[model samples]
Target: MRSTVADVMTTEVASVGEDAGYKEIVSTLLERGVSALPVLDGENRVVGVVSEEDLLHKVEFENDTSARAYWPPMRARLRARLSGAGALAERADEKAAGRTAAHLMSTPAVTVAPAALVIEAARLMERRGVKRLPVVDGTGALVGVVSRRDLLRVFSRSDSDIAAAVEDQVAEVSRWDRGEINAVVEDGVVTLSGPVRRRSVAHALAGAVCGVEGVVAVTNNLDWEIDDVAPYPQMGV
Candidate 1:
């Protein structure tokens, strides 16, 4: 079965309340060896995420005569322009003077459900440019945290286990016995070689094997009896 975020997440996560002081957040992060902390409200529901980058923004602007030089790219130019230059400058100054997690955190925290697939968490992290994600329950309460390292644990599955899973996937996809389609796994690479009844079955088998957990790569050497993918000649259409 595919692993979910809960399967590998660290349940004992370190989090900070919205009113937590900046120095307290920094100390918690260092003590826990985490790069970010989920900001929780009074009800223990996650409201935001405060990362190293968010904290660095304060230091980046502090004592700087020209904050524009340290400003992030114009990714939010439309919003900045709409708010006006003065408002944007005020916001940066506010962040620099901020003392609480609520003031410094990135709101609408990028969170993932505990039941989400590990791949889904990995993709969300990549798309959001985060190194970790807060695993929340249905009520938005923090249950755990999943990092890049946690999601990569699936790759540690034994070679034998991967091979067995590949064989099972091939059998289910093609309804072919071991003799009809052979699967050999080395390290995490799968090499399938044998004869298939239909061209479509070969493609299906390869794709199914590729989805198996711990599969590093797939080398398909299967031959088919018929060219099922070829277009048929039109007859007086």
Candidate 2:
């Protein structure tokens, strides 16, 4: 029988309330060495998974669009009048205080049942490009978390596997992997040959490359390895 998530999931989980303070949430995450925590409702059911990414996004989006973040979506002219010359205030101030974790958590969250197979879980993660999934019960209570990092735990990981791979070797004439052969065309077609757990990951990566300035198409030769992942190049081009 195929192993289920319960066979590998961490039963001793740390969670936070939906209304938890950002300071406390972050501190708990760091203390537990966890990237995310379940946001619970009053009944202690899973509402969403709050990740470091979610928290950082608040700071990041505000930094990227500094003006509206400080001032509450007022008219551009009014904003310009409030802050000096529309340069986004250029400094942090009292105006940017109301944002909280509740403001950042993704709701109506996507989740997986603890009885699911790893392949099914991987497919969903690849489809969504999500690093973690909350394991829940039928009533949507958080049971455990399955992170991309958790997937790596089944096998004893090594430093050599940390870097992403943009290339790989595939069967000579028996290209059995699903989806098109991973390839990119710009000045020329860049064929990708390697293992990929899901067709979605391959397509997502190759699609980005295909959209480049001079790219035309992508060919695929990606494979699936149940035991490990080959990290790919971070630079899309």
Candidate 3:
């Protein structure tokens, strides 16, 4: 059965304005727990994707540079020295905070119509080496996003059948030796709320649950805290 882009893409995507401050943009991405955000214009059309990697470029431009960098068309030796190693980098770091999405965006975006076939979307994703494909209307308003995770939904059995499978998996996980590693699942939302010794464990746990048949997404609430608070605060204690 062929599915449409609407069937696979995530509808609730985060976006930011093109003219927005670099600091604000980075904050929004972090708060939303997203590696990248679509930069949109006044019409809500996607102008570019601002990822963590792009942000780093802005940082580089801010912290490094020389006289030739600011004035340009200088003597050859000075220009050459300014262009070398730490010079440009220092200028990059200094200028990064001022850089806007308009300066960094790679556009015009590659988009697919909502009615595009899932197989076509898969091909596009594979060819582009991009994990997410944005579904859009003729006017370029973002409608949804599809990724390899959505593609795996193709193999899902039925709801009743998957319910039993989830139960069995949950039971097995419960028996696993985990002290502070908490596991929770409800209605396709899996929440891992606990502290683990290593970052790898946190990632592995999230990945394992997200790989489960009925799991739509895994929210890793794990925190590696050095201090512990009382589970129940005594009255005035």
- What C-alpha lDDT values do all the predictions have? 0.87, 0.61, 0.67
lDDT of 2 at 24: 81
Poorest 10 consecutive residues by lDDT, candidate 3:
170-179
What is the C-alpha lDDT profile of model 2 across 36-113, one tens digit per residue?
A: 788888886888767786676446546655555555456875767666755433322222342554554666677889
* Each prediction's TM-score versus the true structure: 0.86, 0.51, 0.52
Model 3 C-alpha lDDT per residue in residues 43-91, reported as the tens digit of each score: 9888777777767875555535673267544585476676694575444
Candidate 1 residue runs with Cα over 4 Å from true position: 65-91, 173-179, 230-237
Q: What residue pairs are clashing in model 1?
A: none
Give model 2's TM-score versus the native structure. 0.51
| Per-residue lDDT over 151-178 for candidate 1, one digit per residue giving the tens place of the 0 to 100 score | 9899999999999898787777556533
